[model samples]
Target chain A: MTRIEEAIKQSKFQDVYQKALVNLIYTANCLRDEQVRILKPFDLLPQHFNVMRILRGRHPKPVCPGEIKEVMLDKANDLTRLLDKLERKGLIQRNLCPTNRRKMDITLTQAGIELLEKMNHMMEQTHETLKGRLSEREAASLSHLLDKLRG
Target chain B: MTRIEEAIKQSKFQDVYQKALVNLIYTANCLRDEQVRILKPFDLLPQHFNVMRILRGRHPKPVCPGEIKEVMLDKANDLTRLLDKLERKGLIQRNLCPTNRRKMDITLTQAGIELLEKMNHMMEQTHETLKGRLSEREAASLSHLLDKLRG
Candidate 1:
């Protein structure tokens, strides 16, 4: 039995398909918890880091909440609320789009970029450590399987 | 590029390892959202369904908060708060343990059992539909790879 099977005290699932479904959810939480631990020192939630990362991608260019929503993995996150918190934290800047007053523009502040740089380094380390558990080949295969699962 | 590649607007990852990491988290969210949709009609959160499932496992026997906590996938869910909600919904019953006055025992009410039976049918359909996307062999391989990733 895997950690998930053991964790739930279930020796077996109905079948491999059902087992895979449960495993996918459990493994994701394990990975997320690791990243959450790294983000703790920065006083950032995982979603905060994610928004920061997206903002960094926009960098000098401004983005709207809808634009940020397009790329966010967790669809449940409220982009407006997240931007509000980031704005309050001084991590991001918000303004009206110069071209369109009706639209709001959001961009990473200097602090936000700096924070992401630090987080990217930390995440890189975490990713590397996690990758150590799987070989390059295994990692590639895992990615392929995950894609197909969603297909 | 897969859906995740497009979803995050990253054509390529730093490497397959990084891609796998992102894919794992995204795929988990996808599965979770699907389950969340099914639970929506019942006006219950997935964690609530999870608690019911655990109690159903114990059936006639009552369980304690500690026992329920041990097997919850989302460890962050406060078992006591969850039991309070479930008890209010009339899906679970809590009583003092005859042998231990300091502890309480919880069990699934008949309504809870009925709810789960309906959910199990819905879940079975969802699982079957999801499994159809992959062959049995692919599913097994996916499960094994996921297990290895956590190992």
Candidate 2:
């Protein structure tokens, strides 16, 4: 209780549901912040890592900016500048999609994949460490509850 | 599975904890989007609501910008502009601190409290609706797992 209470510096929430919402958001931010810190070594922001991850997941395949935007975790933010930066860094390639000439297809370069793979194990280890406090059953329950929360 | 899967357009995750992290973040964003929608009517963003709620909680006690930033959920974001906006809107007041002449004290105006009270029932209904899917036990379990995850 003190961990979270102290993290946000406020013990009392408006109510249980509100408390849960804040906890969920706060914890997610903590996770995001950790990722951001980890990514800082690579001179990348969380949103930048997010795009790289999306492109990496689509490896050997190509996606357009719109497609990346569609699935982005931080949709409120615009990714044009980040894309431009990644493109300049030679971590990503942007070209006219053959299928849709008007659409710009964003693809991860070899360097990008290498970079992501370089960070993959560390990220997995971090996630495992961050999640180590909960048992498998608790992790499953947390996922289930979160899925149900949106419905 | 289709809900979260389809929203992100990716089906399988590498592991359960990873899946849970994604789910937690996705659901928190979902909750945030809902709050944004509700807050739209009031022309207030979630961060703004957060500040108002914070100031309202400290009623009769003036707080400085540093104090508010210390407790803000999205502290990474600069609050000076937000404070400026709220001040311009007459929802919040900022003045020189009597105790610390160099520091600025921020507080909610009467209209701010009124505005918050006006939305209180609606916000509670939103939370109630969001929490409706889970039982109290499940909600408690979700909160507990999150706390443990951060431990």
True contacts kept of 2: 0.68
TM-scores for every predicted model = 0.94, 0.92
Instruction: Return the DockQ of model 2.
Output: 0.62
Candidate 1 lDDT over residue span A73-98, tens digit each = 88635678878888898999999988
Candidate 2 wrongly placed segments (more than 4 Å): B1-3
Q: Is the docking of candidate 1 incorrect, acceptable, medium or high quality?
A: medium
TM-score of chain A of 2: 0.90
Candidate 2 docking classification: medium
Note the B-chain TM-score for every model.
Answer: 0.92, 0.92
Q: What are the runs in model 1 whose C-alpha is more than 4 Å off?
A: none
Q: For model 2 chain B, give the 10-residue run with minimal summed lDDT.
A: B1-10
lDDT of 1 by residue, B57-138 (tens): 7789898888888877776456788788889989999999999988899999899899899998998988877777888898
Best by lDDT: 2
Worst 10 residues of 1 chain A by lDDT: A1-10
Measured on C-alpha atoms, candidate 2 has an lDDT of 0.83
Model 2: how far residue B61 lies from native, Å: 1.7
Error of 2 at B115 (Å): 1.5
